[model samples]
Target: DLDDPARVLRSNPETYFKSPEEMYRLFPGREEAVERTLEIAEKCALILQDTGVHLPGFPIPELYRNADEYLERLVMEGLRERIPGAGEDVFTRAHYELDVIKRMKFSGYFLVVWDIVHAAKERGIPVGPGRGSAAGSLVCYALGITSINPMENGLLFERLLNPERVSMPDIDVDFCDERRQEVIEYVIDKYGKDNVCQIITFGRMAARAVVRDVGRVLKIPYGDVDKLAKMIPGPGVTLSKALSTVPELKERYEQDPNVRKLIDLSLSLEGLARHASTHAAGIVITPTRLLDHVPLYRTNKGEVTTQYEMKILEEIGILKIDILGLKTLSHVDKTLRLVAEHEGIDIAMEEIPLDDPKTFELLQKGQTIAVFQLESAGMRDLLKKIAPTTFGDVTAVNALYRPGPLGSDMVSDFIERKHGRKRISYEHPKLEPILRETYGVILYQEQVMQIANDLAGFTLGQADILRRAMGKKKAAVMEKQRERFIEGAVGNGIPKKKARTIFDLMAFFSGYGFNKSHSAAYAMVSMQTAYLKAHHPQAFMAAALTSDMSDTNRLVVLIDECRSLGIVLHAPDINSGGVEFGLSNGEITYGLAAIKNVGVQAVRSIVERREEGGPFKSLFDLCDRIDLRLVNRRVIENLIQSGALDSLPGNRAQKMATLERILTEAQKRQGARDRGQTFLDLLGSAGVSGEIPLEDVPEWDESLRLHKEKESLGFY
Candidate 1:
């Protein structure tokens, strides 16, 4: 046993650091053991290699020769559907993208994503328009993997997959939050469940967090530790950097022994793994048993996940995808459902017009309360200033509202140019077409690539590499790219000095270049939500309220938004209120499920019994007909307080007075029914038609009623 001190030799135990000489001096006879340990260490070292991606083949129908053929057929069919009387440029772009995808051997990957999206759509699940650079692929657009047409938006396929730099192309899809699992399960069933698993994530200890942890373990005062931690400046600041920048922390560390010890220990333990958990969106699908490639980890809740995180899986060339569940899609789905049910008009998200005058009017007013991505206060302010008119303007606004653009004069300059207050000139006449969309702002990464391709005689793939070099600011790579760009530009009839100037301007703006593909997709969602809110405020606000019914703070904001939109919200009605907030007769009815202490089970029991028989005529009729086990005394009290029972004959105070007797009698009936005894019906029929007398109690005053209502429901 090497661990046995008596059997093995070790350097001085008190010392944390020991030289090789100290080890040999401690045990002259164990020199062979030390050499053997180093030999084993060399053998045990692991170097991860880039073993190219191992994606499983997507199964196409037998009529197709391979994935590429099937994908092409589907793309052509979809293109006809997406664009009636498609132009030559659309066909050329589609062919170019298909060729690139086939060459990259990514046909299977695209088909896999297409299949998932197909399943979601066929099942009536709302999927996002697109996300990330994948939206730039015309093939993705044609295949219905993305709803945004790349050709129409000037998105570059090279941005999604650079042929010059061969890396895995990521396609993250968002589905309705309520049904995201259905898609995941479909994947698991197609690929064996054992071969598919989510990725693990590690939460690392930052400087402040590490200091607090070490201090807590060392039994320091919480206030002292908190003060010291706060003095470390912002997050990710190490103790060494903090000491150099923060004078008080440095002074205390030098003058106090406890502070010195805490800092010393924290420095050693910082950046270590604090905990391991599942990544929120990443899922890894392997070609074979998952354990054959990576170790499997079982979470505390028994969910199987890969021990390696997303980056590690990517580095090792595994097929990892992100299936994001966005609540906005859920809200959109619910809104569309409500519109169809009440107004008999079915609204397809894809069919919503981008140039709806009412939608633009709403966007101009900065009245987006629950609209996706444009609800933030700063975004709202930007919307009012920009007063976007076109879909492209909305996309540009989404891209320009980021910190890098907002912190500079780019946003203001673009605004001025768009409003005709400032001159919009390009670096060269040739650059006009590329930068014309954003008023010569160069607001997208794709624009940076386009300039290189058009002005410098670079291929789209090479242009993508040039864009990456500029974005990363890699000094050596940028120098080479600059020389090539200058030579190419000069040969193409541009002066060398002007070419250099254009390159420099691009480098400066590249840092603020947002992904136009992502912006366009996000704008699509924003327009969809805005369309619903613009035309159907009552149904949309009701759906928005239902989406956030569980969050009290968000509910308050949505309620206020409802009021601002002139949408009246009624109290929950005992007979008509459903589990979710419902639109009833042109008004919003509060959901029974939103009321505190009334669980989904209680709401289901109430709604089912009402639909089965008829409206509850009295409290006894409701309690006696519905299953009382789910709707207990606390649930009944909450219902009474929330005014769901207001439609009945009793007031809030009267309902509360007789709640116990009703529940006791209802429980007796439920227990008798459960035991298969129908003898209770002989006593009397407690059906909806029969009215039960209530204990005569005065109605609660307005103040008390409102207070109790506010307590039962998050808002009055």
Candidate 2:
């Protein structure tokens, strides 16, 4: 009965549900099985042990006694290199951070992160300047784990690690996407493979997805189901909440019996595990075999992963780091390599002047097609409207161009004050310096903390607490902090009215304020990409095209951008271009591998043949010079249609017309050559000089030519 499809389809939460007692009646033997299971469960006892942190220790040299000592030595060395002749205040800040880190038992964590970044640098992999709140740590800066100087950037250390609220420091590292796996492999080698595994995540059915899924299982029409699903608003809206909030949906549920049935079934299935997969960036490394602590499961792809998800693993004292793969890093690295290869100049990302006028000019004009972060449509509009001339403005733009800021007058006010259309003023004189960079707009959460510290006389840590309390909107906590802030302000000679006003403003803006550390770090990346585009347009665009080679829509946009930049892109040339799009003679060349149906191996064979011998004189020359096994008729047809063979001979129509005969002749000539027969011996002539001419044919019409080009190359 359970195996019957009709009964399965008939089952629903409203009318056809089974009780536990009915299950015993449905299958009489089940009661004995249940009793036996409960007896075994009663015999078994489980205890939840408080396992301490299981982070793998960083190996230090004999000269250093512990990870803390080694971290100090490395910080001292990096301090000299990063900031020469550091002042007493810098030393004092560094020592304070180091002391806090040592006391918190996170020296090993910092050293481990430093080692990963160091390995990335040594191997020439592109890592982001910084990510998340970790950028606020001077210790991170000195160790070269992060590039931003917290003191200069006004980033607060408390935001990263509040000494009062102790938790594990999480530092998510981003690497060039193309080479991110290499770093993960390195970690696996250092820590035994048994101790390292990726974390698993479950994908739950949400409101819209559950609607469609239940509809499909019930054999409802896709269009009707899709319309019903679209009525549920966006992600994270539960079906129950949607039915209550959406008037149309509730009316339909009351009026349409089928709609109510579908939705009711969907609600039962909602939030259940739809599938399980590996986490994209989370990988755990333990001090011993991972299975000894956490149970492991093998994914369908044959990857061993933890049964517990990231949060569960964290709760059980396992260390998980997000080794995020960012494609923008790959684009930057490739652009730098292209710059060096094409024009004999060495360009380092760190050495690129952040204050380059040309870079800002390009950004201000909104020419950020391939620029990181600023390439979005809204960001581009923001850039053009703001016309940012400083790197600080770029960072502020990054922080402000979000849903919270855009939905309110925050972005408009920021723009107006930036252009002086609106006056920039603070409630109190002490708020000016803290909000000056943002034109008196509280654009960053760090600014909120700073304002609290400067005006209310709270320590940075206590200020962090106020920021959190305001962000979480806990009435009790907010009242207590308000009292503390007003009392502290009165003690510091500030009027209570002014202090209350500032606190209210902070509370209102705290919800919209962004992380300055993350904004500055990503803005630095955006600047690096913009700098390359300004100085090395051809190389940068070529690299951008190569990175997005597989994405047709992006390729079309990039090609248009190349045209706007006044860079002429020649058609793919069999003799010149390799598998990737590249720069040649101050112009971009189309990559042969970008064409549809043309494999990389086929491109490699064509390039190898052209490099070994001279350039192919004609279409026949191309077929005769290369093996037809890899570059078969389909490959040849694609190349001609894609314009890769345009330089070799007759027009696309003519080459395609005579392709079959040319391939036959080339195969015969190969057979003759294998028998040690020269052209003279095989054909009784000294050499075969020219291509065989088929009946005279006109070139493809302009419209047809462009259509074919778009078909094969993804763009005309």
Instruction: Give the distance in Å from residue 101's predicted Cα in candidate 2 to where it truly belongs.
Output: 1.5
**Steric clash pairs (candidate 2):** none
* TM-score of candidate 1 on Cα atoms, chains taken together: 0.90
Worst 10 residues of 2 by lDDT: 682-691
lDDT of each: 0.89, 0.87
**Per-residue alpha-carbon lDDT of model 2 for 1-716, expressed as tens digits?**
53234674645664765666776787787788755756897889878788667788678899989998999988888888899988988889888899889888888888878888889889988988889998899999998888878888787788778887777788888899999999999889888899888999999999999888877877889999999889988877899999999999999999998888888888888999999999999999888899778999998899999999888887777888899999999998888888999999999888888899999999999999999989988889999999998888999999988889999999999899989999999898888898898999999999988887888788888888888899899999999999999998888889999888888999999999998989998888999999999999999999999899888899899999999999988888887888988988999988888888888899899999988998988888889889888888999888888888877657999988898888888888877888998667656232356356654689999999999888888777
lDDT of 2: 0.87
lDDT of 2 at 69: 92
Cα lDDT of model 1 by residue, 1-716, tens digit: 52233675666856676778888898899999976877897899766665677887688899999989999999999999999999999999889888888888888888888988998899888899999998999888888889998888898898888888778889999999999999899999989898899999999989999998988888889999999999998866788999999999999999999999899988998888999999988898888899878989999989999988788787788888899999999999999999999999988899999999999999999999999899999999999999989999999989998889999999999899999999999879999999998998989999988888999899999998998899889999999999999999998999999999999999999999999999999999999999999999988999998999888889899999888878889878888889999998989988889888888888998899999999988888888898876777889888899888989986889889988877776777767778788664525454543345788999999999999988988777
